[model samples]
Target: MSKNKKEKLNVVYSTNPNFSYEFEEEETPETLDPKNQLLYVLLDKKQRAGKEVTLIEGFIGSDEDLKDLGKLLKSKCGVGGTAKDGEIVIQGSFRDKVIELLTKEGYKTKRKGG
Candidate 1:
């Protein structure tokens, strides 16, 4: 090989924002144990008014407070519901909306069933 034909190549590394892009990492998740209780979420129908209900199960809170929160949510949503069987029964098929609201309220949720 000729000396002139062989040339050394220089490599460069950069950290410029305009030159590099990255998908933002998810912020640290809330500290909640999803085990033991079996977190579950579902959309069901209320016996009365045929109102769609968002059912959240496997919660790990006191019965009184859980019921209180359920009542509060119903009032906020301008609907009617109840807390029973260690689950929060909210009137409305607000699957995504409830998840968003609960996450803000420090509840870890997992969507269950289709």
Candidate 2:
């Protein structure tokens, strides 16, 4: 009935009085080295009311690292955006600038989607 009880849905009853439920936590992947990561920089405007945004994808790393990279890019480009779901979205069409910034940070970048 409670939140904790709902988690242990598999076991209706436990014979052992000392029985405890072990919850498995998902682990985030380690952040890869900048030079070893291949990132794609693109311009998108499909669902944004015709406004353009620069998207950086193909990043294999933890969420923290992704947010840090997004922060750096946003600050350098003087724009606002978000980093989530393994992608960084910058608030404007700055594909070339994003690629240059990523390159300066030692990341392998490729421009995409004209």
Candidate 3:
């Protein structure tokens, strides 16, 4: 292994004057495809300053794919929102439209909340 890539397991510091530990970085898991992912479209209006937002959740994929889906949804709805924490937030209450879009993309979608 390369020097930079190889990590040391030596102790960095000892607080109890007896033992110490080293922190190691963990490997990231691969992202799943949209077709294999289960998504949900729901209408949310809480804590939004009286504005309604459509939320798409249950996504298990990479950040790039999430951003791509967010961009597509925003463009199709002609609005703006954010995609983070495995959820896509679309501006306005476009639950039906969001479901339509997601279904067309070969994703399994379910509508939650009224």
Q: Among these predicted structures, which one has the highest TM-score?
A: 2
Best by lDDT: 2
Find the 10 residues in a row with the least total lDDT in model 2: 1-10
Cα error of candidate 2 at position 58, Å: 0.6
Model 3: per-residue Cα lDDT over 33-68, one tens digit each: 768888988998889998999999998867778889
Q: Score candidate 2 by lDDT.
A: 0.91
Q: Residue 31 in candidate 1 has what lDDT?
A: 29
**What lDDT does each candidate get?**
0.67, 0.91, 0.85
Q: If both were scored by lDDT, which would come out higher, candidate 1 or candidate 3? A: 3
- Cα displacement (angstroms), candidate 2, residue 4, comes to 8.1
Error of 2 at 55 (Å): 0.2
Q: Per-residue alpha-carbon lDDT of model 2 for 1-114, expressed as tens digits?
A: 245755664687889989987654558899999989999999999889999999999999999999999999999999999999999999988898898999999999988865
lDDT of 3 at 90: 93
Model 3: residues with Cα > 4 Å off, grouped in runs: 1-26
Candidate structures ordered by lDDT, highest first:
2, 3, 1
What TM-score do all the candidates reach, one by one?
A: 0.57, 0.84, 0.76
Candidate 1, position 73, lDDT: 64
